[model samples]
Target: MKFALNSNLRPLQMALLGSMTVVAVGFAGSAMAENRVTYKSAKAGTSYYQMGVELAQAMKEGTNGDVIVTLEESQGSVQNVMEAPSRKGNYVFTTPPSLVAAAENSKGAFEKKPDEKYKEIRALFPIPSLTMHFVTREDAGIKSFEDMAGKNILVGKGTFSANEGTKYLNLFGLDGKVNLANVELNNAVPALKNKQIDAFVTAGSFPSPNVIEAAASLPIHVLSMSDDQVKQTGAARAVIPANTYNGQTEEIVTTSLPVIAYTTTEMDDGTAYTLTKTFWEQRDKMAGNAPWWNGVTPEMLMNVSGKMHPGALKYYAEKGIEVPATAK
Candidate 1:
């Protein structure tokens, strides 16, 4: 076969080739990077969810949408840390007891060895919760933990409150005396009002919303933490002064649970660094959504306990903040 092309054919071929290349580039641009990270927590409607949304919004605005964060709620604090970096979420917000347990070389707790998977986790921040308050009727004559030794106590398994409080209970030899009931707070609260359970042990923010609501209808007293008790547990605690919450004119003293909010070390350092930087830089936007993030500062992030990635260390140093004392 013989083929003949007119001189006009050369320019048309070049234009067609250019059009194909341009279309290819456009499609690649539209694919978008899959850099979204998930954050998980338990306790529906708790402050952690609010904090997570704030963080996600900060990520979007900071990178001009290059990175994103999503929240997965209602997983127990312990579960949040374990499954986060691997499956549902990359970030875990929970109490330190659980994170410390996750670090344990315990069998069957983590899917992979500490070096392979556990090392992926890092402590990003501390939320700082308070101890499980043991609230009894004021006239019950129970002014301190010593008084509740032989009474009914409420607890749920796997709660940080249960784990830590049990240790102290044993130390004082009250573990055998208290009639331990494995029940939810809701079920136990009503019973306490009816003289069923002497006191309920629960870990929550000071002026527990449940305790506050219960007090509006009935009278109750939150047991005070003795200096000896605080020293024994060795966990950071705070006091809920009298009138800290509505309905109680007198101080409702309690101790802090002291928790940490963490992320997995498994994520690429660049991803971790960007997240750490963007969250702090755009913290005002985050604080708008969840006032809980309000107290955080750039200097605060530099002082966290767990391992920090090299990239995160670099960003902190550039901001005139020193690297964490133990950063590698």
Candidate 2:
């Protein structure tokens, strides 16, 4: 048998051969690249989610598009802390330090039994301080936390907001005196308008969407906390900033807790180091998207109460930034 190829067929053969070569190269490049890590964040539009999107984009850019990251929506800080440590996969999460401490100690929100796996969790970075907002109707005449006595309030339905609200009530000796209306945040504004609830408490990044919406429709006031009480709760003093809401002229004095990014101890040093370095180097790019990402210095990221991921520590050390003794 003889095979004859016309001159016109030669070009087609070469083009097909070139296409195959390109596909082979592409596959080889994909195989050599690092696996994409899953980044867990809160619901869309929330500060956590916004920051997560920014960080993932920055990581992808810093890694020359080799280290891909995908975001998974979650139940925000409290639940994220409880589940992230035990979840299997190349994953990172955001949660408050108080919840991290709770998960480690197995008390407070976690009950008396601590989740031992939580001890394996390592700090990556602290995104921002989540300030507590106690919003009430201006007509309610609730001038302070103590004035919440005998008034119905919504602290969120089985959320971290509720947990913290209870803590605040107890701290101010208004626990039994205040009537907590077990209701979700979505119901807060309606309940307030109907005069069913006197106030609602939410803790998150400044200008909370729910609070803003409620303020637009009603006369709202954000209560302040005393410095001594903030210290007792281990919360940093923060301000809501003037004009965060309508009629909010003066900065509202409040307390805040740090929201941190974390990973499990099983994440290898090289990957962790690269991720930490990539995030740190690309932070300026992410700052414009979310107020929470602003001014996130390496020192703040390393100010965690417990030990940090060795990879993160290594990256900071390379930058000549000293890690805090408590976070070692």
Candidate 1 regions off by >4 Å?
1-34, 43-54, 57-66, 73-115, 128-131, 139-141, 149-151, 172-182, 193-195, 205-208, 240-244, 248-254, 281-305, 319-324
lDDT per residue, candidate 2, 59-112, as tens digits? 888999878889989976776777765687567888777777778887777885
**TM-scores of the models, in the given order?**
0.72, 0.78
Q: Pick the candidate with the highest lDDT.
A: 2
lDDT of each: 0.63, 0.80
> Which lDDT value does model 2 have at 82?
75
Q: Residue 2: error of model 2 in Å?
A: 20
lDDT of 1 by residue, 230-258 (tens): 77777654566667545556655545655
TM-score of 2: 0.78
Q: What is the lDDT of residue 89 in candidate 1?
A: 38
Evaluated with TM-score, which candidate comes out highest? 2
Could you tell me which 10 consecutive residues in candidate 1 have the lowest summed lDDT? 294-303
